[model samples]
Target: EKVQLLIARKIELFWTRNFSEAIPYNNLVIGVPKEVWRNEKRIALTPSIAANLVKKGFRVRIERNAGLNAMFSNEEFEKEGATICNKSECFQSDIILKVRQPLISEVDEFNEEATIISFLYPAQNQQLINKLSV
Candidate 1:
């Protein structure tokens, strides 16, 4: 019981120390795009995670139906302060998060200054790397 109490206290302290104050808004935006890779069903960010980011003063934009495959509804994300937008609008964000590598053609939709985070198999898809590097 005592050990459990100590662990709980530590967890509480961690949350308080990290999330007690909202970070000043610096115009940082994170976009979540739907997985286009075949058989990929997971989404990069969940509604809860988006909510946390919003509380920290970050803007989150999710492409329409991005989380549908993961059993998360668009309304769920919107309730957490995320904006649901079309794929093109979501791709315009400063940072893009995806569960799988985007299609080669979709790479051209990304903003030149945007950063992409996803499970990429660069070794197997040299063409994708070349396109993304351009």
Candidate 2:
């Protein structure tokens, strides 16, 4: 009976750990900053998408004026459960999503474990790549 109880406990532990890791989503904060590049007017993560993420337990933060170019107002995002914050606040998230590659100077604003998602041309921007690597 002792051996059977030990085996059952071990199986439960194993399944708990494995299944916990298998869950696809978490309550990670996702940040969306405005496009700062000249003539760049694109914005990532529309209000509808942000709302869907919120419904899925993710927190979405958008920088002020982030969606103006895309004709998306801050009120629209707020209505969809997003928080509109300053540029720096947007950088302090678990994930940062931008429409274009961020400037080298902007790389320092990222959180140590933050993941940046954008359209980067590393070949054309070695300096930016090096800054990001640091």
Candidate 3:
């Protein structure tokens, strides 16, 4: 039985390694940031995305208090198997999907190597882009 258990563990590791290799490194960690617009009740990605990410074997981390404005609670996100983290940690994810342009503080909160995905209204807020570029 001990030998069987060892074999099973090896098989699991082998499969996991293969699966991870098949998926691109960029696709591994996904981040979802909440829009900071005043009275903005819309959320870019909902719990549905979290569920989908879980099914795809990807890790999701959302900014704390981000979904509350949209009426989605932290519990809902957790129930969908998404990891709830602070703004700083969430910005460290490989990909960040956002509904609005990132705040200056939020941009500074990002991990230098992380990829940020958002609808940046550069035309409306050129100063923000300039600030971020610096």
| Top candidate, metric TM-score | 2
lDDT (C-alpha, whole model) for all candidates: 0.91, 0.90, 0.80
* lDDT per residue (tens digit) for residues 1-134 in model 2: 99999999999998777443433446588999999989988898899999999999888999998999999999999999999999998999989999899988889998878889998899998999888888
Which of the predicted structures, 2 or 3, would earn the higher lDDT when compared with the native? Answer: 2
Residue 118 shift from truth in candidate 1, angstroms: 0.5
lDDT of 3 at 121: 81
Q: Which structure among the candidates has the greatest lDDT?
A: 1
Off by over 4 Å in 2: 1-26
The alpha-carbon RMSD values of the candidates against the true structure, listed in the order shown, are 9.9, 5.1, 11.3
lDDT of 1 by residue, 33-125 (tens): 888878888999999999999998889999999999999999999999999999999999989998788899999999888989987799988
Once fitted onto the true fold, the runs of candidate 3 whose alpha carbons sit more than 4 angstroms away are 1-27, 131-134
lDDT of 2: 0.90
Q: TM-score of each candidate?
A: 0.79, 0.80, 0.71
The residue pairs that clash in candidate 2, if any, are none
TM-score of 2: 0.80
Point out where model 1 deviates above 4 Å: 1-25
lDDT of 3: 0.80
